[model samples]
Target: MYRVQTSLTLLLSLATAIAGSVVHHDDSFQPDHILRVTAQNYTEACTTRYSVLVNGTSPGPELRLTEGQVSWIRVYNDMKDDNTTIHWHGLTAFTAPFSDGTPAASQWPIPAGHFFDYEVKPGIGTAGTYFYHSHVGFQAVTAKGPLIVDSNDDPPFGYHEERTIMLSDFFNETDKKIIDGLTSSPFKWSGETSAILVNGQSRQRTNSTGSCQLASICIEPGLSYRLRFIGATALSFLSLSIESHDLSIIEADGHYTKPLNTSFLQIGSGQRYSVLLKAKSEAVLKRAGKRQFYIQITTLERPKTLTNYAVLHYSSGTPADLTTVPLSPPLPTAKTVQGWLDHKLECLHPDHAFPTLNEVTRRIIIDVHQNVSDHVIWLQNGYDWVQSFPQSPYLVDIYTGRLDTGGLYQRAISQGHGFDNITRTFPARIGEVLEIVWQNRGTFTNGGLDVHPFHAHGRHFYDIGGGDGEYNATSNEERLKSSRPIQRDTSMLYRYREKTTPLAPSGWRAWRVRVTEAGVWMFHCHVLQHMVMGMQTVFIFGDRNDVMAQSDPVDAGYLTYGGSAYGNTTHSPVVRQYFD
Candidate 1:
């Protein structure tokens, strides 16, 4: 039997539908979290602002889960006014499953003073770096925290210790104020980040480092530590480094990758990595004459960059000042300077994964660019996504026989085939492999080539890599035969310095997804700023009739707000039983 193991979490018994397929760590799973969401006013970086904090704190609290068994997270929106919903960043459960938590697409925002329980099952393969965050508006900037899932078996790699590094960008203003400026009629852009933070604190800008508020981690002189780096920044792409040490990467987005050693690395929002760092020996420390090293972070590729620091402290034999700063190290070479996020990352455990990056049944091409219009708006295949909150959440509409196909159709262009949407949705039948291509045209207004970190809510794709030109399937056919690309929940679509029109791509990235889950899922740029201007869309697996016919009964809890009431439906996916 599944039981809750934590004060804030509880669990229910696994359903009978797919009982035997579940993976158990100790022959059972536990904990269904009740995360409380609230907006708290706090002072930071010499400014006062209110932020959407979970359980009354920024970056919230970490929730741990075991692989397999169904779990529940009852999100209580404790705020006096604002609505909120938490999206589990990465898990076995692709974002396609119900309660994956994207406001209006998967379901409605959990209303203020009310609560919603997200019931999901994390299957066998989902045992690595995942996080929870508010997906509504720009709330993720502050309302986010780590979500750890333990592997049933020992991890492929070994470490003496482990810790987390949450890298985030800070805005002094509130979420509403920032979003309003970007979405304004004349387009008042929200400027660069007020400050960059490592674990929610940073050093003060002064000649003296006496008042540094940086986060610190204590380490033994000679021990191997696994650092799980989370990219929680909303706007900036960043470079991270530590003084006199190397970071050997073991995992990316929850999958073990071939170890790639680097002095430093770049991280974009919504991305995650697990790196192994071996601490310096006592002899090396004695020669160097330092027990503290700074974990440095700086914004990448921007004219005016932001920077921050955290401390990697060596535990003293006795009580001592661990806060004493160490000498700074020289910056490492930016990998993008060579082009791409190190496609050298092949799957470390291919035998345990799906087949290598390969053949697909259909290709959907999406061109991204800022529109030439009276107001500032971004376009995906000439369609402007002007709605943030739909009257009917897509999943509810589909279940209640109120699914709207009005203005949704196949969009054929010179580039390729995709979907055109007023409601921003398209359907794909089960058992079909789909290739999604992102062609970044940037903007006609500015020559700025923005690197969009694209993220799909319900689907993790077989990544086909990215580069500074148009995607050519014809040329890459033979290349796929020998490569097993590492999977990514969030991957970057590049943009180059080259001159090109929206129809003429400056850069591109591609991914292959096999339709397995039946639900409405979100697809978009992980950069919240880009999504604010409509750089997003939706995907629905299985035809409407097939979905409605085989769907289980809907809970009365879901049908209350924006969720439509269905005459009859079940919570389980009876439709999936037909799969091989």
Candidate 2:
């Protein structure tokens, strides 16, 4: 688990940089922050409409955290119409399961004008790039921001400065408009993005973006800067590259990875990465007559492409001739994606290496499909995520003896369309090692390049291996021999380019996890529209008693809103924004 040392001699030496490779638990983080959720008129891409905001900002505020520290964030829902719940995306919420902030599965969405306090407790070794976004509905399109969890010690890599390059897709239409179209009776699909945004900075959609007011990051010569990249898009998969700079990826989704050097970096929705970018010396900048460089981000996977840029500005140099920074946007293909999945992102932590177990306690292979029956729908393991009415938060209900495992399984068998053996809720005993495989099918490679980025809530998993078509355990055995499984909170399942087999599965990605956390955690496609169409499910690790013992009190604000615990007595605004 050797980390790549920066070649820049101005940075820390190899020994100094690698000394912090072994992450230690720190319990000193005690941050108490307040996030006021409100809806206001926000203008982006020549459109002004009411969009969700946190603390009066569209992208919210950067939340700084420390590993092993339990922080409290009180969120006041100032919005007058919509419900809001903040999912501390990528934070394990290891100590308190209810703090996961998922509606119905974890807790109720905080009603309008109400407030809920979230407890963020990242495990000792779980500190890195993460984000927090509204988990309610389409609000996440504009209501999210960067979340960085620093380790107790210095990072294993040397850097003089760090910056966040949060990439997002912008639509001319409002979030409400898109949500309406996707949920309509006939199911009109939400179209492609109008423009790509880098750190919420982009120009109006036009024929050319050369005059765009791009996001800027200041830098000093001879210094290494850590760029924390977050993919906060609603539907866009993106590829980014810097002018004359090769990215040395040091971390992904809070897990340290052996530095992966690449010219182009692809990011899926809900995923995060920390890459080291060394600034050229002042003398080099002076000689090249360039103090500014372009950080180009282009939309990938889909048919049309939208490209945006950000600038890396040096502190001391003659004004850079910005016009001279050439941009040769790479043409992304299925091969590019396959190369990424095939290349192992080895863990830097020695203790977190790929396991050598002969077997697992449970193995599940789920077929993912987008089907159209009475209406367009997305299915996960053959079940719609939405529970039938008399619906309540599973955390509360399961603990109250209202939801038995047998009854829940029976309900799934009766209502679901396929995989009666697997239900919406996959229950596993605590401490059991489990392997989950996702099989994507019925997608054409000719024109449809729908990449599904799966996000895991409450915990991360070791990504063992993935490939095109159906999953074969015998064949996977060969992959295990060569794969250096990396732990990640989110990973993309690429679409296979196979026009010959129209009905064959496009791809498969497998995750091996040791169920140590006790919560009904969600595993779903990061595409917001797909999740709205019911492409989601929960994994119940440990029993009801186990979750209840670790969850917030039954009378907590989040639990009482829309949750069955006090639905008859409480008075909160009812919300039916999300699919489930």
Candidate 3:
């Protein structure tokens, strides 16, 4: 009996080794492309702005790749003084989390006049409209572009043509000035956006009279068009719509979803959506006698009511001339605007069922609030994130036993809320399912009810459920159960209502993620102002044994390259060429 059992075990081990060898020997992989992105100053958008241009363009160059194919991109920082890093915003680097492009967490920022090679191999299921942007400072507000991944197979739906619409809220003030005001005493928030842009162009209205030179899309009357909408704003939640059309949402943040039709879309910062818009029939356009329709974008936040407009022209023959197109209609009325708001009060993404969650192994509850000492600062679980140096990154510290586990706390004392506080990090293990509940606690001065878009690095999560009020396991049972929840990397946490007669519940958002990657990942508010004010935290996945076993040799090589200073021209050949 013992000899029979031993024979069976030996055969099983041999079969496993053969399977592993087959995977390792696969030779159908494509060669990597080295993308040289340069950061420089450019005069654009009716102002001489200090912008980060990728390959000399404000929107940079489009990076096209097939899904599941490994890519090697080398970004060269040519900015005279600023430091930067390019984050593959929606790609989950899987077991290779070090390439996630989060400064101070996975790796250090690429210094001026240096280069960093990012090796990204997005997992099998991630394919759709994703983008790349600077992860450090305010560079993302300017230096950004589309990173589209085509599926190995055709999409479930059909489209005749495609267009990429990158949305941003432009400000006349420089990034440095905006940071100074945000971090100053009495804490000044960015009041309102000076201009809103679609595809890097907008009509610069001068005294209510200006030529409409905004981005215009020429389309045939009866074709289906796929419009990829990316909200890369620094501080704006936009309500976007077309004059006479409905948007059929097919994908969100690189994940395919069930088709959902909506008249308007509420896009927060760092969010992306691919919607299909079928143009009006040729007969419909001929009868109307107009080939143009207005694409309106309005800010949902305060300072004042602001609106931007673009044109979508449909023609069966030659493209219509811009000068002949009629002016767009006036802005919607207050009542009409309120009706749109009412329609989206649920704050759910267009598709409510998809990418269901597994059984949760751990649960984390975080309280988000604002604190004022010398200046206003945003906090997560009573702690704010401070950027650490590149040489002593969060992952390296944790791996080398430099991090003190005893000092990690769930909440910070009000007296110890200053800059001297140690960094806060949460620990998890690989393969463990985690449920994070983000509860919005009202702010210090204001009613505390403000919308915040939460973004996570490395991987997407299932947005299981959310509701207005504090999260209670018992009272909020139904909201948590969903068979097909939307899977996304960025989600909006709406504000709680002020308690008038009866106490209102605080707003809460809950998401579930399985820890498949083995590195430090950052979760923070997508609003650049709020992120700089310290509303962020890191999740250190895997223990010492697990991390060491899954470590990537490629990450170590990049770390050594990133650590070499530019002044040491003799020692670093890459830096000497760029600097000289």
Task: Estimate the Cα RMSD of every predicted model relative to the unseen true structure.
Answer: 7.9, 9.4, 7.6
Tell me the TM-score of model 2.
0.84
Which candidate has the top score in lDDT? 2
Query: Per-residue lDDT of 383-453 in model 3, one digit per residue for the tens?
Result: 78856432467766655666643343222222232111455666665555677888787765554456788
* Residue range 455-491, candidate 2, lDDT tens digits: 9987688887788878887888787777678888889
Q: Which segments of candidate 2 are over 4 A away from where they belong?
A: 1-31, 204-212, 317-335, 339-343, 386-390, 406-423, 443-449, 498-503, 549-553, 556-559, 562-580
What's the C-alpha lDDT at position 491 in model 2? 91
- Identify the superior model by lDDT, candidate 1 or candidate 2: 2
Using Cα atoms with residue i matched to residue i, what is each candidate's TM-score against the true structure?
0.86, 0.84, 0.82
lDDT of 1 at 578: 16
How many residue pairs clash in model 3?
A: 6
TM-score of 3: 0.82
lDDT of 1 by residue, 1-580 (tens): 1111211111111111221221211213232676888887865554567888888766778888777655667677778888788889876343223568877776767766666556666668778887889888888988999888788888888899999888877887788888898888777777788777777765555415344366787789899999999998898888888878889988888888888887787787888999999999999999999887777787775657666667888888754343433343345433344244545778887643343334356777788877645567777877755335467678877766676442243332222354645455656655556778888885776544677788877768778767667888865555555666778888877676634544557888888776665667778887777788777788876545544444444444455572321111222211111111
Q: What ranking emerges by TM-score with the best candidate at the front? A: 1, 2, 3
Deviation of model 2 at 300, angstroms: 1.3
- In terms of lDDT, model 3 sits at 0.66
Q: Candidate 1 regions off by >4 Å?
A: 1-31, 92-97, 207-212, 317-329, 332-335, 351-358, 372-374, 386-389, 404-416, 498-503, 545-551, 562-580
